[model samples]
Target: MQFMEDLKHLLDISYPIIQAPMLGVTTPAMVAAVANAGGLGCLPLGGLSPEKSLALVKETKAKTSKPFAVNLFAHSLTSEVSEEDIKIMENYLEALHKKYNLPFEHKPISSYRFYNHHDQIDILLDEQVPIVSFTFGLPEAQILSQLRERGVKAIGTATSIKEAALLDKAGMDAIVVQGIEAGGHRGSFIDKEPLPQVGLISLVPQVVDTVSVPVIAAGGIFDHRTIKAVFTLGAAGAQLGSYFLAAEESAASEVYKERVLSSTDTSTELTQAFTGKWARGIGNSFMEEMKNSGLVIPYYTYQNSLTAALRDFGKSGGIADIISLWAGQSASQSKSGSTEALFNKLIQQIKSDTNPIF
Candidate 1:
């Protein structure tokens, strides 16, 4: 707990544990449960508009008086697609629709707007939320300065030391050192080159040594042993996603949770088929078909919208073969349990392992 002592000034939490802000999967109930249990809970507001986000924030406030963070996508707005690129995506979906014998709903792909962080920033500023974190990319210096001025803590996700340094230089309160074993999209800044495949054990120490800001270790950290290891390596906290996804309060679809638990091997693979940008998920029939077809679609929001219907349909019908089961490499360790129980288990395990001799 002494290692966690430093985070109190930054995050104001009793435990140096943060429930990872899993987009599309983490719900308000989940966030409230973790925060009420003494860990920092985060709600991913990437898919929500300003109005909806405000409502959710209000609901979470009603649920718990504890501090929690709201996450936003800080990436630049996606560019408009050309007619030819649209045709390619349409054709690709049409083939899948026919094969699956599903209805091909071809509406114009509405341009997905990047969340207006400025608008949400104003809302959070007014609400005076304790913490705000960002992924996909860094925000403008002015935004960072503004949050700091308002006494709100800011954090950024990084998959490399260079990115961590950039965040440090850009005035982040802390940097989440996302290792290669992390699920969902890899937070690689600059070009999408092959990321350095460093595991959490190796990644945390180096990043802690390299950066002056606090390093929060993430990726493949599922249990107490991993948490203790990260703390020993100088991490102030550990951000866990997959472990929380299996909790009863999580909004992850039932089928998705089953797949994560049923998976015998932790054989998650990185593929760009779902979102163009590479993300790690459980391998399934859809991924196999996409791989065989060799079809690389447009960037995230476009391809994400194009396949939204199919994913929903597949998930509803209890078919995991086609849905995006975004899971981390340590996903096999996940189990179905109440959120409070899971949090207590993790905390107890850490205490049991770290107790000194009498």
Candidate 2:
């Protein structure tokens, strides 16, 4: 109840929980389900065209009237691919295709060409979305101000103390402190170089200390004990991702669910092999082989697009070894159930404790 007082009121939700906006996994139905279940459901519009993004927003709106958030990737985009990088990556992927007995390609096939933020924000404003959140980086202050003027709350993801402080200073309604243990792409864009892996406990309180705005703790928080641990560390709320991967409403493939559910705390690792951006996911042939092969490639989204087809091939063929199987360390503890059921389970766990010690 105490934890709920700040975030619940801030987000206008009965509970202070936030469902992590997992791209390629989080669905509109899932977002609606989470909103209806009393948490801030977030829909990730990363790498989507404006039209496609609008379709998802409308779909979610049709299902639930409860407050929900829309998320976007705020990282810089590369429109043109480098010829040398493309040639090298194409050869590498061709070999991988042969090894996996998939189709071979001579040229690098592109995925999403443009990641235009201004156009996407225009769509959000046009739709009159309730809450708008961003990962990778923050949008321009003026753009964010436009959202606030139109009565939309803003949330930003931060993987480091510095990033969190910047978001707070930039007037973010809430900051999600995305610790190293979080699944999928690291929402880090402050430093050009890679950041040191900081766990939830070490990062949360530090960011909380540096920022005046409310901070929502993310990563490795799958249980009530961990939820209370986050609050104990000064977080206003918890954002759950891998915990709901096995939920009935989740869009994760059957193999992905099995891998996440069957995994142990020691089973996953952070690797840039999948997307050319550091992220935590389960160990498989593709990740291990790519990391060990010493293949040079492009960065972030461009690199992510280069390898997209292999993931597509893997997913369609039910080859778990090649696709990205993202999961946090607490994945083993995650349960499979309906969205509402998982939400209630969290509430029940908290209520069971007379007072969760800080």
Best by TM-score: 2
Q: Write the per-residue lDDT of candidate 2 for residues 1-358, one digit (tens) a residue.
A: 4544777787899778889999888899889988997888999898789999999999999999999999988776744456687678778888888877878655434534667567699989999898999988878889888988999999999988888888988899899998888888788887566675788899999998999878899998987899999898988989999898888988888888888888998988988888887888999988888878787756777678778889988888788898899888888887898888998888888878879532
lDDT of 2 at 252: 83
Write out the backbone clash pairs for model 1.
Answer: none
List runs of model 2 lying over 4 Å from the truth.
Answer: 1-4, 78-82, 104-112, 356-358
Number of clashing residue pairs in every model?
Answer: 0, 0
Can you give the lDDT of residue 87 in candidate 1? 69
| Cand. 2 Cα-lDDT | 0.85
**TM-scores, all models, native as reference:** 0.94, 0.94
What would the TM-score be for candidate 1 when compared with the true structure?
A: 0.94
List residue ranges in candidate 1 displaced over 4 A.
1-3, 79-82, 107-116, 354-358
* Candidate 2 RMSD computed on C-alpha atoms after optimal superposition onto the true structure: 2.1
Clashing pairs in 2: none
